[model samples]
Structures are given as structure tokens and as C-alpha cells.
Target: TAAPGPQLFLSLCLSRLKFPSDLDELRELAETLKFYKQEHYGYVLLLYCSAYLYKQSFAIPGSSLLNMLAGAIFGPWEGLFLACLLTTSGSTFCFLLSRAFGKQYVVHFFPEKVALLQRKAEENRSSLFFFLLFLRFFPMTPNWFLNITCPVLNIPMPIFFSSVFIGLIPYNFICVRTGSILSEISSLDDIFSWGTLAQLLAIALVALLPGALIKRYGHAHLKVDGLDGDGRDQAGRHRKRR
Candidate 1:
């Protein structure tokens, strides 16, 4: 067996690529993987994979493994950047796609979930990016539901992308670091070791720190200083808030 798993994955993820209906191309791709497992090139592949997955269906299964692969192939820095960028881009693409597709699409694809979206819509409706990030954070919720409905409901794109990109940083960092660790270890058992889990947890916290800071700062700054319905600070010079 040539071990073309990643190659097949790479090809499959590209929405633009036309896979043969016969699925025979997968065999050749697999065979080719046995030989083309270049470290540098693989890093690039991982980035493409992450982004493409986001673009195609927002299904980033095995994201930890992919991130670990990134660390293994790119050795951390470049790998981290690639993983984060692609993940963010993919997420943003879905948010935009929601705008174009309409409510029926969301209903069909995400029929099972739609409850708390109203609260979220009210809260982050004003801020797409943060709302998406908040969605990404405590997410057992249906993503596509939010994506499609956001636009129809009149949410702006800037807020959606910004929140998603920033909010998702913690999770993405954890996934990427996991991939790096996988690259480091010799077997699957190592992946279950306490150290790996600890490392991922640490990275997740680190990534979240900035978002927390921003949140705190925003809350601190957003106070209207008892200006009634809005406008003007304590002294009354017209204090506009976020």
C-alpha cells in the first residue's frame, strides 16, 4: 500500500477538484502518498486541507490530528499560522455562504437545531465576528443554522468574520498543537498520554487569553456612564459607545 491517505484527503477537500465518480482516483492518490510525504509540502497541504474543509462543509473532523500533522511537518510556527488562517477562512466562507443561500437551505441542512439562536441573534446580531466566536466556543449548536439565518436576519459580515476569526483562535490553536504533538510521538498511545492533553489545554487557555482581554476591555469601555437612552458621558460631551 502506498499510503496516500493525506493525498486523497487533500484532493477530496478541494471543492473545485472533480473526483472521478468511480472513486478510482483515490487509489492512485493513495499510492502517490506513499512517496510524496514531503515535510515542507505536507505543511502546505495541511493549510489547504484546513481551509478547504471549512469552505466545503465546515466539517473539520480530525482537526487535532491535522494540527498535529502541521506541527510535525512544519515544526510549529509556520504550521500554527497555516492552521489558524485556513480554519478562520473556512469559517468565514460558511458565514458568507449563509448570506447567499437563504433560510430554506439552513432549515434543510440544520433542521434539528435552532433554539437559542434568537438570543444569540439579539446579542451578537450587532457583531457577527464575536457572535460566531461565541457560537464556536460553547458549540453543541448547529453552525450552518446560524450561518444561513444570520444574513436573512440582517446581520453584517464584518462582525461575523471578526468574531469567528478571533473567537475560534483558542480552539484552532489547540487543534494545531495536537497535530504537532502527533508528529512528535511514535505511536497512538502517546497521543493519550497526560502530557499531550496538558499541552493542548495550556495552548487553548493561552489562545483564549487575548479574547478574554478584549472582552473585558470592551465591557469596560462600553459603559454609557448613565446617559439614559445613550449619548454623552458623565459630563455630557457626546460619548458614543460600542
Candidate 2:
């Protein structure tokens, strides 16, 4: 069973003193952020950027919270741009770090998943761009999991970065838009209403279209290449038999 809201709130607040669990606290934060933005704009920008990168690179929590804050601070479009840029940069850092230090340890821990991902990588090497984009778009895999495992699976850097940047746009825009309206929100329910979910689902469907098309069309070339090799082997074997 789930804990009571107050109990969960208390536990979360105790663990992270700055985590805003209620609308009142979020409103307060918004006001404070406005003052800081007016007073110490450059310094605050640097701090926010550094903190965002550090959290993502180290696999820490608070990215969603930061995205919300970005919407509140920078407004929707600017916040979305900044969030996407930082997310891609931070994920790239994590990817490179995992390749160097954590790949072996991560592979040891998640052997089956790693093997499955590697097999998928081999099978989709030609259309890996779309595959990675779909993976990034959906929540089937966690970002941290992908960051570490992609290196082990030998996915190239360009594909990984491109997917992260493009795939994050829809969800990032949602969170940022929520932030832009944070002051008017009365409860969590308001933020994730049915309307919001439908919009997100529509966006997710759009994101998947490219991957579906690639799967449908990209296999023909691979099949033709395989057939050519098979024909050569058949002719060689017939010559030997004769």
C-alpha cells in the first residue's frame, strides 16, 4: 500500500530540505527566483547550468524538478531550449564517463539487458538513429540506464547525442509549460490532468512514426545484401560439386 500523503511528504522533505512538495513552497520558490534573476542574473545562470550538468552526469535525482524550475525561471520556449541543451551535454558526459569507468561494472550488474541491447544494436546498425530516438522518446528505459549501457553496446556518439536532444523535446516542453503555469496550479492533479496526458501521448505517437517507417523500409537493403552473399556461396558450392 502507499503511504499517506503527509507521511510521504515528511519523509521527502526530511531527506531533501529544499524539495518543494507543496504548492505553497513552490510559490515561495518562484518569488525568490524572481528576485535572484533580477539581482544576480549571470551568477544564477552559471549555477543553474553547473548544477544541471552535475546532477545528470552523476546520475542524481532532481532533473525533473530542475526542468520545472527552468520553466518558472526562463519561461517555456527559452526553458525548453536550455533544458534540452543541458540534458544533451550532461548525458554526453555521462556516456563518456561510463565508457571509461563504469561500463564493465554496469555490464556485470545487468548482463541480460546489456546483451539484449547489444544484439539489438547489431541488428539495427543501419537504422540505429531511429531506434535510439524511439528509445529516448519512450520511458521504457531510464536515461541513466541508456547513458551507461549505450557505451557498452557500442552505439556511436552522434546517434546517442542526437536522440537525446530530439527525443527530450516533447517531454521537456511539457514540464517547462507546467512550470510556466506553476503559480496558478492548486494541486498536483492540475499539473497532470487528462488533457496533459493526451497531449503527451499524441507527441509520443508522433515521435514513434519515424522509427516505424525506418523499420518498414530499412530492412530491404539488408535483405538484398544477404541475398547477394548467399547467391555467390551457392554458385561457388555448385562449381566445386561439378
Best by TM-score: 2
lDDT, residue 160, candidate 1: 61
Q: For residues 1-242, write the lDDT of model 2, one tens digit per residue.
A: 33334444446435643645555666676655555566556655765688789988976656777787788887777888989999999999999999999999877766656666676668778878776765665544567778877899888899899988987776677666667677445778976888656655664665567556644654553221232233334333433564
- lDDT at position 195, candidate 1: 87
Q: Point out the worst 10-residue segment of candidate 1 by lDDT.
A: 231-240
In model 2, which regions exceed 4 Å deviation?
Answer: 1-25, 184-242
For candidate 2, what's the RMSD?
Answer: 13.2
Cα lDDT listed for each candidate: 0.52, 0.69
Q: Which candidate is the best by lDDT?
A: 2
